[model samples]
Target: MSNMVKIAMTSDLSPGTGTTIEMEDQSIALFNVEGNFYAIADTCTHRGGSLGEGRLNGDIVTCPKHGAHFNVKTGEVTFPPARFGVKTFPVTIEGDDVLITLD
Candidate 1:
């Protein structure tokens, strides 16, 4: 089972940008890609780096700590230094709110 949590508003994040959201003692990384929203684990699998502070290029986010790349839309490792993929959450937009499904 999963619960949809409202992480942010559409206006909170612009296209090609990302932010970190804290809820239920978990850190979630939210990204806005061309008006589409995606959610993933904020911590990089390789290191304890903040994925929210990473550079967003298209749908991929590059970790600032060691240059590891992760696909925000799928939470898959795209580049080196990170061998494992992070957890991905389904995103839903309702009116002005951005919600993500969390298990």
Candidate 2:
């Protein structure tokens, strides 16, 4: 396994919001639920939309383009037209920093 990268501070992300970070030529989306952090592919599985720009409701994130919903915690597709699931990264919180492992 590779080392986890410190993408952002835990305080950097607010609840029900997400931030985008670029790593290894891939865009990853980091979300904050209360104090917990979740990371997922920034690209939506359907229509190539940006997941970071989507809205978050509980653990589900709805794609801005086509209304595709995904569970940020598990990367599961909750609604269509997103039949495929996006990638999710492992996230850890160290003090005020949020760390994630990239593919």
Candidate 3:
């Protein structure tokens, strides 16, 4: 089973940007890509870089520490210094709330 946790409101995040969300068990990178939202594990697979602090271009986020690139929509490594992909979470917008599912 999965639990949906409300992280922010739709109005809180702007398009073409990202933010870090700290939960009890994990850190998440939440991105707003042209109005659609995506959530991924905040840590870069290469050197524990913060993906939330990375640069967002289109749907790809570049790791701030080492330039590893990840697809925000799927959490797949697009370009690498990091061979492993990060984990992805499902995001939903209900009314004005932005929620991510944790399993």
**Best candidate per lDDT, number?**
3
Error at 99, model 2, angstroms: 0.5
For all candidates in order, the CA lDDT equals 0.93, 0.89, 0.96
- Please give the RMSD to the true structure for each candidate, in Å: 0.6, 1.0, 0.7
Q: Please list the residue runs of candidate 2 whose C-alpha ends up more than 4 Å from where it truly belongs after superposition.
A: none
The weakest ten consecutive residues by lDDT in model 1 span 1-10
Ranking by lDDT: 3, 1, 2
TM per model?
A: 0.97, 0.95, 0.97
Consecutive 10-residue window with the lowest summed lDDT within model 2? 94-103
Residue by residue across 1-103, what tens digits does model 3's lDDT show?
A: 8898999899988999999999758999999999999999999999999999999999999999999999999999999899999999999999999999999
Q: Using alpha carbons, what is the TM-score of model 3?
A: 0.97
Give the per-residue Cα lDDT of candidate 1 at 73: 82
List model 2 lDDT by residue over 1-103, tens digit each. Answer: 5767889998788898997888878899889877688999999988999998899999999999999999999999999999999889999888888888865
Model 1 per-residue lDDT tens digits across residues 1-103: 8888899999999999999989888999999999999999999999889999999999999999999999998899999899999999899999999998889
Angstrom error at residue 68, model 2: 0.2
